[model samples]
Target: MKDPNKAKTERMMVKRTLKNLELNRMAACYVETKEDALKLVRQIIPDGVKTASGGSQTLVQCGIIDFLKEHTKYFDRYDKTLSPEGRKQNEREAYFADFYLTSANALTEHGEIYQVDGASNRISALAYGPDKVIIVAGINKIVPNLRAAVERVKRHAAPANAIRLASGRFCENTGVCISPCFDENDLMCHADCGDDTICCNTLIMKKQRIKDRITVIIVGEELGY
Candidate 1:
């Protein structure tokens, strides 16, 4: 389908699904543009609240970290492994924090939120552990259906993210980059070593995962390159 048609259908489906979930949805300039997204984040994050992250580079590229530092002393737990102490911090600061920010690869027309993560903490918080979840996504991440959303994540977001995660690792240093291809020494783990490993952290979210705790923030510009 044409991009316009696909967008229209997605808007309709998103509307229906959000209504079913009883979530409050709104359209903002940041929903399409980087500058606007920053502005919106500023408006939403209030005084005296801590923030956590999932290591989304787009958020950093958009200067969100600087903005947060200027506004408040929020802790960014982006790339750090989640620990018992970190979970305590998340719970302790939960009341004061406005929302936890994360990124998603695709948003289905039916309002399904899709995220492919190399770790579980971000996905865990976005799913049900947090009071509010805000998802930042590029315009290209929007899709017509659940299946298309999954395909978009695997083909586009997953590969890019895999390479990004592997950039400084031994696998990237070797002959090939280990992304979805599952190289021998991918950061998650060596495929030959074990199957029940956290190396299988790239997660595909759907269905009940799109509950009331989440909000979708769509950006007009191309992000997460």
Candidate 2:
């Protein structure tokens, strides 16, 4: 289904996000729930389209990843049958997939999506590489502006994600962003968290030259870190 026109709260946010996405040369919609999100993804993606996805808890929870793995030529990096070299090859192939799926760390009301990465493959594919980028995010990820967006990522997203991945960063043990960089102008973590750190890179997605190259689906429920 196209963007729904019911529910005052849902309707308003959908309109705002869509308008800003249009201004930024992207497409977007708001869904009422995780179930709606699953259905919307199916409608957007045609049958047999080669698909790939970055690591995203939102996609997993919505059953989007499972559906793609079963139906499309998905870049299956998680397949244990593949050798180490095969896993590397799959990652390479993901760059050329017809659709690349992922989730954002934070979304600013100003229409920018913010994300931090450890390996940066997700960030790279998000900015460019894939023919089409489909991002699924929850309304909980939304922030007032870029500064708040960055803070949101650090103060909440990072620490929780660190524990999940066992990245062993300061936040993982403490459950909050006590990174020293907060004192400085940058909101990024200047403290070293060893080789397993997840805060190595950051990306703030704003206006894009190619209209509709990216599409965002905002679900009502909270998902991902």
> Which parts of model 1 are misplaced by more than 4 Å?
1-30, 78-98, 167-212
- The per-residue C-alpha lDDT of model 2 at residue 19 equals 77
Whose TM-score is greatest here?
2
lDDT of 2 by residue, 21-50 (tens): 778888988887889999999998987999
- Scored by CA lDDT, what does every candidate get? 0.58, 0.83
Off by over 4 Å in 2: 1-14, 80-84, 180-184
lDDT of 1 by residue, 28-67 (tens): 2235467888888887778667666665777876787677
**TM-score of each model, in listed order:** 0.65, 0.89
Error of 1 at 219 (Å): 1.3
Residue pairs in collision within model 1 = 30-37, 31-218, 32-219, 32-220, 33-220, 55-78, 188-199
